[model samples]
Target chain A: AQSVTQPDIHITVSEGASLELRCNYSYGATPYLFWYVQSPGQGLQLLLKYFSGDTLVQGIKGFEAEFKRSQSSFNLRKPSVHWSDAAEYFCAVGAGPTGKLIFGQGTTLQVKP
Target chain B: IAGITQAPTSQILAAGRRMTLRCTQDMRHNAMYWYRQDLGLGLRLIHYSNTAGTTGKGEVPDGYSVSRANTDDFPLTLASAVPSQTSVYFCASSVGSSGANVLTFGAGSRLTVL
Candidate 1:
């Protein structure tokens, strides 16, 4: 079965520091990977997606993700973390032809002043 | 706005009661879905509709049901609410049922069954 795994449940980073959130997926074929962010009391927003071509995909709010086919991972990275970047991040893999997504347990990022 | 809208931002219900979570999308997307979010469980798909008049069961669909009478509406119904059904329900839609389509999510409805 197709599935996604986000290793870190919670992560804290100092403002302006570099950040990386790890994600790994298990799928039978070429995977469609995505990263989504959810603010408190709000719906999820798409950050980035990797369907094909270009391993490094950039997204909104200065977020980027690299899809490593060999490792079956698509980890999100940010060069400088901001206070507003504190939110729950989810890694998901698009499954089948229905566009259904299999999401991993989210990683909560907390920015420290 | 041209996005998904979910009704009953939050609701408290007693076990054995019936409840419906309404979802409407003005985007006129071809695919709509319902998912339940829980701590440590991520989000599990409850049900999905590929198009009008067709529905499919998802990862978790034992106690829940759905009907898609039209392209814009997909309401999830709980035949008999249970304590385990307490969750934050999210309704999402995509332009199509292809892997390349990105899903747009609603603000979500927090449901509590006591």
Candidate 2:
């Protein structure tokens, strides 16, 4: 069985400040990781994904995630966050080509002005 | 492009009533899924279909039923709605293999059984 953990239930960051959301996963084989964002009343949107290749992957809205194989972690990062970035972020892991994603509890990001 | 559209944005139903949530995808993807989102549980899969005519159970499929008669539609039905089943339901679909494919999600259907 595979699982994902986003330790922090909530995070607050000042506008223009750097932000990092931690995500850890448990999987036996090489895992496929993804970061998704859901704005108020909106659907989940893919921020970034890592299958295989360079460990560091960049995504939309200046978002990026580093896949540390040894740590079993794929944490999302942003150099600076905007007020509009206030949303819920989810970390998910897929077993294989099935695309069945196991999601983390989620992290609510609040951007303070 | 209209990725996925879920009907009845939100609904409140009485216990023991029957309900079917409709989901459609214009992308013509080969796979579709249904998930329920709670405050702290994130998203749990209820059912999924790899392709047309085939459906499979997911983590939490006890109270739900699904049908995949065609490529574009996958509807989830609750045999007997219960208060515990009240949660925001999401419909998603993917193309080809998921290793590199991103599953596009619908806005979601909020169901509340009273």
Candidate 3:
């Protein structure tokens, strides 16, 4: 079965610091990867996705993710984290032709002042 | 706006009661999906529809039912609500059934079965 794993459950970083959220996925063929962010009491928003192009993909709100096929990893990165960047992050892999997504357990980000 | 809209942002219901969470999209997406979000579980897909008249089961389809009668509407129905069904349900739609397409999600409906 295809699955996504986010090792870090929670992370705290000072405002303006760099951030990296780890993600790993297991699938049979070349996988379609994605990163999503959910603000408090709001719907999830797509951050970035890796389908077939460049390994490093840019997304909304200055977010970027690098998809590494060797390690089955798609890690999200931000150069400088803002206070407003505190939210839950999820990594998902599109499974098969039906467009079903297998999501990882979310990582809660806490931005400290 | 061209986005997904879900009705009854939040609802509380007694166990064994019938409930329906409504979802509609103006994007004219060809694919619609229902997923339940829980703490520590991220989001688990309950059902999906590839087009107007087709539906399919997903990872966690039990205890939930759905119908896609038209292009815009995909309502999820719980025949008999149970306490375990309390969750934040999200409705999402994509341009097509291809895995490469991005999914646009609604604000989600918080359901509480007491």
i-RMSD per candidate, Å: 0.6, 1.4, 0.7
lDDT of each: 0.95, 0.94, 0.95
Model 1, TM vs. native: 0.99
Residue-level error in angstroms, candidate 2, position A89: 0.2
Candidate 2 — which pairs collide? Answer: none
Q: Is the docking of candidate 2 incorrect, acceptable, medium or high quality?
A: medium
Q: How far off is residue A50 in model 2, in Å?
A: 0.3
lDDT of 1 by residue, B1-114 (tens): 699999999999999999999999999899999999999999999999989999999999999999999999999999999999999999999999977789999999999999
- Rank list by DockQ: 1, 3, 2
Query: Residue pairs in steric clash, candidate 1?
Result: none
Model 2 segments beyond 4 Å from truth? Answer: B97-99
Which whole-number lDDT from 0 to 100 does residue A54 have in model 1?
A: 92
Give the per-residue lDDT of model 2 (tens digit) for A1-113: 79999999999999999999999999999998999999999889999999899999999999999999999999999999999999999999986667789999999999999
Which candidate comes out best when scored by DockQ? 1
Query: TM-scores for chain A, candidates in order?
Result: 0.99, 0.98, 0.98
Fnat for the candidates in order: 0.79, 0.61, 0.71
Ordered by lDDT, highest first, the candidates read 1, 3, 2
A6 Cα displacement, candidate 1 (Å): 0.3
